[model samples]
Target: METLYRKYRPKRFSEIVGQKHVKTLFINSIKNNNVSHAYIFAGPRGTGKTTIARILSKSLNCENRKDAEPCNVCNSCISIDKGNFMDVLEIDAASNRGIDEIRKIRETVGYHTAQGKYKVYIIDEAHMLTREAFNALLKTLEEPPSNVVFILATTNPEKIPQTIISRCQVIDFKNIPLKDIVDRLEFVCQKEKFNATKDALIEIAKRANGGLRDALTILEQVAKSSKNNIDINDVRNTLGLVSEELIDNLLKNIKEGNIINILKIIDEVYYSGRDFETFLFQTIEKILLLIEENNNTEFINLLKPLSDILKDIKYSEEKIILVKLGFLNLINFKENNNKTTNKVLENIKKESEKIEENIESEKTEVMEKDIPKFDEVLEDLKINGDLSLYIGLSFAKIQEGSDKIKLIFPYSKKLHFELIKDKKSFLEQYIKRKFGITKEIEVILSNSTEDETLKKLSFLFGKNYKIEGD
Candidate 1:
């Protein structure tokens, strides 16, 4: 069965939804008898480069054409529409991009048209042509036969040599607007007799990313999948899209400085089989919208770093880990608007070092204290057959300061803290045995300790990152 995009493709300039500028130029040129022998159409894929090329061929060869519009009823128009026109040759440059093919085109360029007034050659993916192939076709393009027209279409115009580009009329295609794509989808639904909600169509359009053909194709898939009526939920399920509700919850968490919930949500989204890159992009999109409404500089500050990380996520072998790190970095960003979160930390570290230097230079008195040690606890656990507790506390650090003892763990050992924090008496008993005091005990994450831990994690996981939380 033909796809909706292929079946409903624009047959004339009037039917094209966008690119009014390109249409106007072609119409004026045809009306003025100023049609060029060679033309180049450059744009992103699914934006109607090849379609426009075919339309131009039909209009030029139509028995009846008005204002550069092809008469659909004419024999030339029908043949071109069906892709069976003898004088209209459609070549896939990706498949035939060698010097031999260009030579064959050169050989055939002098021959008169078999059926139409002017023979048209439409080369798709024109950027795929080899340098040698382009060199071979250069002479023909410089001074071609009057009875032939060449239409070169490509998504990446930068790949084409400047010399080849200089001899052709270049037209750039723009991405269709979201509203335009939605309207087109609605039109397709009415023609196909499919029931679709407005929001459902809008969601499809958003997923299409300003491609009309993609929107129509998604509409067809959703129509078939629904087997009754299409709704927003149907589109979400088909695309595995994270809901706006979920994104809002994420925003709320970030605003409230809830790092644990943010990390948990990332894990849930990753485990649910959502596309991580798409999730990051949609997350960035949602953040931008929130920044606009609330005028929050924090979100604005976090946006660029997250976007930069999102680009790097595509190359990651372990996407889930990178996603977790990316979110953590955002959560860890400080409230200071003057500097990025990382820079603030660097300044704080430098200040601390300066303070230490001053203390050393002044010969300040230092207090001595017995630090409650973890090695003794590990030995105790090993002696008592408590391997689970020993293993859990292996990565934890015990620091003793004036009037208090704190057990600090790296963020990566969150499960370990959960296990041992509940056994407060067990940890305190060891503290008393080592220090002979009942000082208050606190368990938490150490920023300085985590800095070192994250360095090791970077070595193990391929990226360095930090999150702020206890």
Candidate 2:
């Protein structure tokens, strides 16, 4: 069966959605009988460049037409629609993009149409054609061939030579509007008898990102998987889309420096079968919005790590690792730059003599507890035959807290930290069994040693990151 994009493709000029500007120009050109012999249709993909080209081909040759529109009943329109018309030829310039192919067209430019007055040539992805081929085609486009009409469609018009561009009527096509895309999806739902909710169709349209063809393709995939019944959940499941709610919550957590919730959300997104790149891309766009409104430096810092994850995404099979690590980097950047939290910590630290005296008294007693030290955990990992985990965590500096074991790593030990963090459960289990400490295991990245600022950093951030004081 033909896909929805093919099956529901616009068969007439009036039926095409969006590109009112292109349609308006072409209508006046055709009505005036002054259509250019050579034309360029430049736009993004799925924006109906090729569709309009074919429709225009029909209008140029239709035996019976009404106001620059094809009648669709004539032998000309039927044969063109069925892809058997001799006068209408579509060339995929990506594959046949050389001088030899251009020479072939140059040879046949003057031949009489088999059954129509105009012989139309549509070159799709015309930008992929070699410079030599474009130069060769320029010769033909420059003169003669009164019965021939050439339409070149490309996503990249800037690559075409300026001399060639000067010889053609360039009709730039914009992306279809969101409302138009949704309305079309609704029409498809009605005609195809697909029981899709309005919100579901809107979700599909948004996912399509202003491409009507992409919207219909997504709708059909969800429709087929749903047997023509689609809802928001079906669209989410079919497209593996992270919900807007989750995406919003994630950015909120990043801004607030909520490490635990951020990790939890990453788990939710990963288990929902969402693609890592999609999830990261959505978050980056939202962060960009936040940075734009607030002009906040911390939010801007989050983008570098998020973008780094996008590049690193292809290097690993388990994407959850990169996502979790990237967000951890975000949390670190956020918390370390939190002026409000650090200010409170500074005031508290100023009067620390009393608290320090109190803490010093309890510190002795707390130290007597069976809390695990970082070295003992490493020793336990080694003894338990986890040599890789033992070796990976071996480089971390030890900081034993009253109720936790803190492991610190430098920037150079990032891979080691990631490896150890990935196996936190196993390491936690080993420490609990061997050391009798029910304490949580915390991992962090920092370049500072045990000092006053490090302690403030610990207070500002969550348990995932810890910095100690002497």
Candidate 3:
């Protein structure tokens, strides 16, 4: 059976949706009698480039057409719509992309139209044309016979040479919007007398990702599977799409650090016949959105380890990891039921909580520490290092100090201490070398006391060291 999308593919320029700019240009060109000999239509697949090309050919040859619009009732229009138009030659450049093909086309270009006013050559996937083929066609494209019109279509315009592109009027087609796809699908459902919910149509449109052909294909699949009233759930099941609720549940489990629940959800999704690669992609997309929202950086950080798992495009490997590690913990509910999984999950959750607690406790301890004032420490160091180089190390303090000199470090106590310990002796020697005198250096760790450091830093490095508080 012909799918709804194919069955209802636009037959005329007016029927093509969401490409007003291209349509307007073509219509105006025909009206103004300024039509180019060749045109290059490029964009994503199923964006109606080929359809528009055929329609334009019909309009050019139609017995009756308004401006550039094809009169669908005319023999020329009907033949073109049915792909039987003699003067409208459609070539699949992917299969016929060689110098020989170009020679054949060049030979045909010299001949007048057999049955139409202008002979039209439509080369789909024009980017596939070899360099020789493109070069051979360049002269004809630039100065084709008055009776010949060339329409070149490609998904990737970047592959086509600038020389070829310069000879043709380029029209870029954009992906059809989701709302437009849904509206069209709904219209198709009405025409076919099939009950379809808005939600179902929207789901199909989203899965189609702005491709009208794919959306219609999915819609046709669902229509065949469903007897009446296509619901969102029906669309999900028919398309094997993981449910948003399920995705939400998985995200919640990951956010709560419930590894067991996460595993269980993975198992459930797998058992429900969802592709693991799809799941991984969906998970990655969801995580990216969460990261954008700034609501779950910690969860994002935790999932960073799974980057390798997401890197593989093969489904089998993804399925293995998702089924074994992600879902295995959730599936053992029958033995210990939810109890065992919950216990393990809870344990992991507690460990994460404990780690967070430890971090907080450390922070509090640092805050309570009796660290030296920033001005005093800055005076002791005397701005020895280039301030610009060390400016990013904003939060510095002293771990240990004396009246003669002070030890300087970063706010992150460990890094600060480590850096001081590593560079202390070298820095001291370097300073002494620069000053031509021995200098006593004290090492101090910088905790979260950034304001004090900034005040003293401004004194040593001038107003340029004025630090902004977060």
Candidate 4:
């Protein structure tokens, strides 16, 4: 059976979705009998760049086309739809990205169309063209033959040469919106005679991330996998995405500051063999909704770290642990922030007491660097919703100071130290919250350099290794 994406591909302009502007331009050009010789269609994949190009090709060549719409029954339209048209050439630039392939086009530029007035060349993945290949095509694009029209379609328009882009009219295609995708899925389900729930289609639409072709492909897969009525669970299972209930529970737990509940959800996600990246994204989407409703930055802050974790999920062995750590970091952030608020109030009381107490007495408490507080400060940082800072501070060592909290790191840890150091003011505020007294915050690289052998040993054995000579 043909794939739904190909089987139900948009053959006409009216069938395309979410890019009314591009369609408007094409319709107007067709009405005026004026079409550009060279054009570039740029946007995300499955947004119908090549599909629109084919429709244009069919309309321009259609013997009985009206108002830029092709008659499906006509020989020209049927041949073009089947990819056997003599005048319409579809080139995959990815495989044939060298100058030699483009040379074929340069050689054929002057020839009259075999079957139609306009010969359309639709080059997909145009961005993959080699720099030399683009150089070869530059002249052809700038001054193409009168009868030929070039439609360059690319997901990445930036890679295409400026000179090539300058000569061609550029039309950007947008990813079809979720509602449109859901509607399209419904249409597909009705035509295929498959039983589908609205929620199922919605889930597929959400999973597609604005790609209508992706949505149809998913729907087709789900329909094949489930012989019975297709529902949201089947869609969820097929996509390995968390359900709405789980997402709701996650946000509720996060808002209530229930770390245990949040961890439980994370554990459920892991045990269910769910895609952590997808789960993370779903969770973040819920968080964003909460932020929109409640205007909470706390949840908003988690997005950055979660996004970073998603980037690294493929590279890490323990992705579940990374996600757990991310949320734990958020929990720690909320806990430490609440602690900071209380400590600031306590610090005010302490300050007033210092005014009444002797200077030496104040020094005994305020000036004394509590070693345990350094761990607390780092813990607070780890939990404080700043994943980058948490990752950075993980590399530094806390040092003793009578009048200041000193953070020392080996030269190798300079990057981490710098990351934490960038948030010096926030660190000071955290210190004041934890210790009820603000101390000078100092970050410095170690003055003593370890021998190369010792450094290697330390790296291999971790920081627990004891140096006999040192």
User: Model 2: runs farther than 4 Å from truth?
Assistant: 285-304, 314-318, 339-470
Candidate 3: regions farther than 4 A off: 285-308, 313-318, 322-470
**Residues 355-382, model 4: lDDT tens digits:** 4553354235433545776666656767
Please report, as a residue range, the 10-residue window in candidate 1 with the lowest summed lDDT.
361-370
Per-residue lDDT over 1-470 for candidate 2, one digit per residue giving the tens place of the 0 to 100 score:
89999999998878999999888888998999988899999988899999999999999999998999999999999999998999999999999999999998888888878989899999999999999999899878989488899999999999999988999989889989989998898888888898989899878887887788888889888998999888998998888877778987877777777889989998887777778888888777777766788875555666788888898877889788877887787677666667668987777876476447645643454344443465566566688768998777666665677787777666555788899788877777876787776777788887645444455556557346843568
Please rank every candidate by lDDT, starting with the best.
4, 2, 1, 3
Q: Is candidate 2 or candidate 4 better by TM-score?
A: 4
Candidate 4: residue 289 lDDT (0-100): 77
Worst 10 residues of 2 by lDDT: 362-371
Poorest 10 consecutive residues of model 4 by lDDT? 358-367
Error of 4 at 57 (Å): 0.5
Any idea what lDDT model 1 has?
Answer: 0.81
Cα RMSD (angstroms) for every candidate in the order listed: 20.2, 21.8, 12.8, 17.4
Which TM-score value belongs to model 2?
0.69
For each candidate, give its TM-score against the true structure.
Answer: 0.70, 0.69, 0.67, 0.71
- Model 2: per-residue Cα lDDT at residue 384: 71
Q: For this target, which candidate reaches the highest TM-score against the unseen true structure? A: 4
Local distance difference test values of all predictions, in order: 0.81, 0.83, 0.75, 0.83
lDDT digits (tens) for residues 1-470 of candidate 1: 98999999999898998888998998998889789999999987788898988988988899988878888898889999888999999999999999999898899989988878889999999999999999999999999988789999998999999999999989999999888888888888899888899999989988887788888888888888898499998998788888888887887887787889988888889889888777778888887876788876556666787787788787888988887887777666643433565786786687567656644532321112134344555576778746877766665666767766676676556778788788767767765775465767788864544343464455446655666699
Tens-place lDDT per residue, model 3, 377-437, is 3334557654532432233433434433455554445555666556657756754565454
